[model samples]
Target chain A: MKTSTLRPLGRRAGDLPVAMVFLLPAAVGFAVFYLWPTLRTMYLSFTEYSLLAPPEWIGVENYQKVFGDRLFWNSLQVTVEYVVINIGIQTVVALGMAVLMHRLTRSGLIRGVLLLPYLVANVVVALIWYTMLDAQLGIVNQALEWIGVDPVAFFGETSTAIPTIALVNVWRHVGYTALLIFAGLQAIPKTFYEAAQTDGASEIRMFWRITLPLLRPALALVLVLTIIGSFQIFDTVAVTTKGGPVNATRVIYYYIYEQAFQRFNFGYAAAVCVALFAILATLALMQLKLLRAGETDLD
Target chain B: MRRTTRLTAVATILSLALAGCGGGDDPAESGGGTAAAPTEISYWLWDSNQLPAYQACADAFHAANPAVTVKISQFGWADYWTGLTTNLVSGTAPDVFTNHLNYYPEFAGKQQIQPLDDFIAADGTRTDVYAPGLADLWVSADGKRYGLPKDFDTIAVFYNKKMLADAGVTEEQMKTLTWNPTDGGTYEDVIARLTVDENGKRGDEEGFDKSKVEVYGLGLDENNGAGVGQQMWSMYALSTGWQFTDKNPWGTSFKYDDPRFQETVAWWRGLIEKGYMPSLAIARSGTSVNDGFGAGRYALSTNGSWMINTYYGYDGVEVGTAPTPIGPSGKRATIYNGLADSIYAGSEHKDQAWQWVKYLASADCQKTVGDKAVVFPAIPEALTVAEQKFAAKGVDISAFTVQIHENTTSLYPITDHASDVSAVMSPAMDAVLSFEAEPSSLTKANEEVNALFQ
Candidate 1:
């Protein structure tokens, strides 16, 4: 009876015009802004476009060159390194904060304070951290000196640059990610924990068996958003390292930026962008499937 | 079937609506529409420091020519190029904009800039009015003039007067230091004596702590400087009689691997090894070298003449200038770079823009700019006036001016694929400076840079 009453509205001819009216504005926006530019980028990937002249179609020449480009591969590897460090720490810390928030105060003030760093602009955060991590004059180095520990060249050494950038970004994003998971925690019933307590199950066991399985949908969403966001890390790198101390922080997006803006190699840049798009799309889909984003333990 | 037809109609309507709203291009406003039509042309420059002088020129220009006016816009250094390039492609760039030697080659090759030969011929403008080689620097490989040189700069050593005195070094000694690639010569001696450790021991003294430096003798503004190293190493390498390319303006071959250049780089890096200069990591840790100099953390800094006001602006600091150290070639050198004005090819008011560019290159506008003492004007007479202005301010700027007088200036490397060259050389140079790779690695990087030309 429920399935009959909840029949898909698209199947009825009478409701079709109403649905079209609602979707028209959004469809127009999508076509003009998103879809058109994407199509153009895809087409430009196979052509030679320098913005000064009309695009000349070269038939996969750019893609062929990308295969041999050492810088492109370096950028990809550096970007992956940043992603692993950023996501690995950010997820676990965010999950822990979410649980703490759910079990404890649930205070809006604490939540607001947690979201403060995320509210600040990425460039601002990067610059502030950059100053605070200066090898000689930064406060962080000064503190380390006070404790008899040697100062680390946070963004200066090639070995430490990518990890430093990733950690700074993790600091900025963890708060927002925590809030997202906190909202997910609120949707789970308190009665489940109470019932588990009555069943003589430990709190940790209840969290593992009940909390995590139900939180899959939210976790999947956060992973997809943060992962996609992480892959597009350009502003922080651009502001701080500028992909230097020797291309150590030259992530893929920054490499694409250098090619397109610095070298004016638009076609090659487009090819790289297309490759990045494919990678991110594949990652997003894999996460959704592995986590069963739509299925709920409650059902 | 009916539902599908309705959906297709909705999609078509949305597509048409998007198409209708997308036409944002402006119609070309006709220039010289009517006699005395009051055509206002737009001009853009990157340096905010020079805005007041340029604005003064604009006011004078408007008074002289009632029918035309110039509106000036200033953007920060990096944003200026990004904005200019985007606007140039979109046909919305200013009528005229400041041009750099590094970028004008690409701009000229792409035909985004207008050739000024015909305009110069029609106006009978004197091309020889600017400093020697300055006018020629803006000519493209096709032998077309793209810009008119407006101002010039040369690098010099700016040092803290109190630090030099406290180190028992006289100003005369500072002015006449000599150097060699082998052991760094007296130049290294002065730097080492100037550097102080945490316990207040000088770098040249026994028991000096290289790890815990209180003050660096030399302040570095950038790491490897993307292979240009204008203020940092250019003076040293050029003093050794080394050039960046096979020839000036449009040289296809680079000489980054040349032993003379490599040895100069090695000596410069050796300062860091000996605790006289900041390490590559500390130098590039987001703090301006000038800040360190201002805070007494740096005793000496090499900078271009354009920063004279900036160094002087630091409170409670008595700054003094010195020519770069004489090298094995028995001569001191500074890199001579200049900025110019270029007209966009798509400008509707090309004639008016040419008038402005001509005026800017003329002694009239340059004299006004010179009197402000902001920059060394391209015109010889105006440059003299600028020197007098500096003299009136009690600042001895002869160290910079002497380069031109002695003909010891090397032109800033002007070549196509400059950005590509920098991209390859920057990391390679960084590796060498950071002690991760040897200086010989620059040879591979130079090959990569040359490969781009092919």
Candidate 2:
């Protein structure tokens, strides 16, 4: 009876062009900004476009050059290292914060204060960290001096530079990630905790048995988003180190930036962008499979 | 869910269409206009300090040629490169922009800049009217002039008078200091003795805890920016008889790998190792080397001549200037770098752009701009007026004039991939200064950088 009544309403609504009105702005934006440039970049990846001259078809030569270049490989390694280490640290730290926040009854003020770092722009965050970590007059070094420790070269030493940048990245995102996980934790039913406690489970046992299982969906979402965000890490490196201290901080995006703008090798840069996309796509697929396995484990 | 998906698709299409239409109307597209309208030429420069002088030149030019309009825009040095590169790639570059000799070759090689041979020929302006070797700075091997000489700057040693007096050294005594590679001439001896603390501890004094020093004798950062790295290295290396490149314009063989080059790096490093100079980590903490000197933390700093006005303004700090200390080669040299006005090859108002360039080169514009005493004119004849103007301000800029005559060399020509080489070498240079790596490792660093050239 309900279906019969709703069928004509749906048909009439479909005929009213409501969806077009709703989707028009986004469609225009995507087609004009994202879709066209993405398609153009894809096409140019296979050609020789030097900005001054018209593009010429060069097949897979740009891709070949990208693969052969040592700097490209180094950039890839740096990007992967940055993504894996940063995402790992961010997840552990954020999840720990989430767990702590979950236990606290006073949430609003603490959560708001904790999320302040996330609210700051990346450039501002980089600048703040840069000033704090400056070896000479920075407060960090001054503190070290007070403690009778010799000042260590943070950005000046290549060994410590990448890790310092990664740590800053983790610090910037941990608050936001923790907030997301905390929201996920909030959404879990209190009855499930009661049930676990009633069944002779301790607080630790309840978390492992009931809470974590139910939080799989949220975990999967955060994991995917964090990985994608980590892969696009350019702003921090650019503002903080400029991929320096002997190229220790140079990520794939910075490399692409150098090739296209600094070196005027647009075709090669496009090829690099395509390679990055492929890497991200593969990682996303693997994440999906892992999430599926996680779901099955919950069942 | 179905309705949301359809709505999103429609919105995406609409947005794409709008963006596409907007993209077509770029500055480069409007660059080509009919001869009927008054021609508008865009000018790009980075320094806000010189904007007034440039604008004054523009106003003087427009007074005579009322049909031309000059649009001037400013960018920070870093943003200037990023914007220029992006605009060049997108075919929307400004009509006329400032060019540096070190970064100009890449644009000239790519033909992104229009050669001004015909324009120079038609205008009948003699390049010799400019400073000696100024015209060659912007000319490629093919004899194509890519820019018009704007002004030249050379490095000078700026010293604090109070610090020198505290060490019982007079200005007359400083003039007698000579230099050689091994001992750094009289300049090094004086600097080592003059650089002291409350306890009478000098930089070369044994049992001096470098980490505990309250004041440094000299301060210089080792990062790869225009100031300390490029400018100081050019002065030091050139003084040591090092060439940025071999005879071939595109060659990289003559770079930092040479033993003499290593000696120069080592000597500079010794300043820190011996506690004569502040540690790189501390020196770089300030916004600039000049800032350290201005704050009274360092007795001496080396920088370009244009910063005299900056030093004069600092209270309680009387400043004096001299040429860089001579190297082992018994020769003192300063890097002579000049800026130029370049027209984008893609501009539509090419004819009008040449007129603006011509007017900037005229004696009247140079005189008016030089009278402001901000920048010395590229025109040699207009320099006397600039000298008088600066003298009236109680600043002795005669060091620049004397240095130009006594010890000046044109900066190395722009290399096609100079920025790339810089990107590669900067970190290595930083490593050496930070004491994390041996100065000799610069050889390996050079090889690694040269590999990028191929």
Candidate 3:
């Protein structure tokens, strides 16, 4: 290994100006579209406003109310349940597929088939899941009946609605996650596995000791993403159950939408959004620290 | 990558910091200020079902008022409200738009809609010329008319004639069917007899298989009509003297706690326990109510006159219409609701917009709209024309008009916080339908609804 140093790209005066000129259009577009809306939402959280009137500042009253509101608490509980279930299923399926694909096939067709669902739009996936899980009309329950099993109320009962929704989410996201992990697996040095084999290490033991330790960065990434995606879930619940069978599947983001858009409670919805932000931000920080790659000194 | 991200974040902050200073409320006098004799006005409506008829109306209006041009835009139901709210905030609202009673009160309160009393006086318009109680619905508590009578809707029972024949029920009995809150009167008997089991037994039989019902007697759909159940339980409750509120157009509180209302809900929900109605879970989603009805699963359905075309569109089915049954109060009741065209308060071409709305409410346009035989127009003469047109289509729409002519309609609830009230009640209503809560628990829901007004 040779000792190396990194150089800054923007050090030269002429280079900085040229680079900025090239980047201005995209940066300006992002600022106008994304940054402004985000700041506006943050500012609105401290105010009580309807679409018809100007915002009136109440200074954290909306936040206090949200913490105390029954619906807010219910939706938060629902979101936590969904996140746990979805992440659990997605991680397992992703890791399993990654390990299996790493050991077995390199077929382009198989890889393409695995990547198809991740590329399908959320609306199409939700529509397919809803149609397949429908209580009376679904093919899933029909197949169950053909196997001499009782029909299941997948989207109807409270005990099953959230899990059923989580499963659909997993089905859509697992392929992408597995592909990401598979990429990480490919990047791992082949020498480590060979060294483990020289030591008479079993495949399972080598995977546990060598593969898992080095896969931390990718796993952390998948975990953080799974958390964010789980919290942001809305369309499936909206189209499938509509938070129904007595609000069994009313996730936090869906609740925020109903309050802000449907009920026009912009301030309270913004408060809920802020709470969600704090959670996601803290999780991201924790994951970053835990998953930072170890560095070896150059000789 | 880190340096680039930092640069982008800094640029974003700078842009927002600059943009923040210029952001202000949308000013009202942006468009249509000084009309050079003739100006084009924008009109928006939610119903694509009525778009063509209104497009024709716009054409004729351009003919009558050659100086003025009207442009129409149609949006889906959900998108329409979202777009309208956004436009109202941005001061880009259409010069004229169709308004619902459910949303108009909030608009009127916020002064987003213009009061039309001055125009009404200038044009010498007679609100009485339209259907009774329709023009009154547009009058606010401040005694200003904000809308003109455009169209009215009433609920009636649509039945499958073949199903009735198989069940040995006659059309005459259906026409004169009466109901009572206690045990449901003769209506319950008819519904039970119409209900059939997989074992080929009627609901009235001793060994009827309630668990294996093949065909339900009633169609309980998810279309709650803003939770008041215009198509389902409105007739049941209204005929039992259970008004949604003490007064409308600005009622202070709801009366969901009323024992009469509770009894009506309980009786309606009992149909599910008897397997005469589909379970709430099954009815609330998955399939459209009309589709379920057409599939021979529902022998009868409480449907609005607006959906007559939707039902008749189903092939190989003999559709029949009958008036709602009479109740214990010695009167049959229907929820009388109407839609209207209202001019936006911020519109600069108020005069031109008024001219368009005036013509829309006049006999000329209303008659033409009625001749299309799509919906029941609000004007009496237009309704007459519509009745003849519907006869030409071989469907008797009189089942809907009878409620209006007999004056058996109680107005649907109209209040300032109608949206909030609906939010508080819908979940509770769902709970009640799902048997998660008792009907009497609506009193607690009433308290929550009343608290919003407080």
Best by the DockQ measure: 1
Per-residue lDDT of A61-163 in model 2, one digit per residue for the tens?
Answer: 9988888998899999988888878989999899888878886555688889889988876766665666567565555877998998876657655677777
TM-score for candidate 2, residues paired by index: 0.86
List, for all models, the DockQ compared with the true complex.
0.32, 0.31, 0.22
**Model 1 TM-score, all chains together:** 0.93
lDDT of 1 by residue, A1-299 (tens): 89967888756777879989999999999999999999999999999988778899999999999989988999999999999999999999999999988988869999999899998767667777876787776678879999999888788878898999999999999999999999998889999999999999986898899899889898899989999999999988886789998879999999999989888889989999999999999999999999989888886
lDDT of 3 by residue, B193-257 (tens): 99999899999999998877778988877554445878879899999877898787578978888
Residues B269-291, candidate 2: write the lDDT tens digits: 78787777876655543224565
lDDT of 1 by residue, B82-137 (tens): 77777877787888889999999999999999999999898788899888989999
Q: Estimate TM-scores for all models.
A: 0.93, 0.86, 0.90
Q: List the residue pairs that clash in candidate 1.
A: none
DockQ of candidate model 2: 0.31
- List the candidate 3 regions with Cα displacement exceeding 4 Å: A1-14, A194-206, A290-299, B1-38, B224-227
- Give candidate 2's error at residue A293 in angstroms: 8.5
**lDDT, model 1, position B256:** 90
True contacts kept of each: 0.56, 0.31, 0.28
Which number leads on lDDT? 1
Task: Tell me each candidate's RMSD, in Å, in order.
Answer: 9.4, 8.3, 8.4
- The best candidate in terms of TM-score: 1
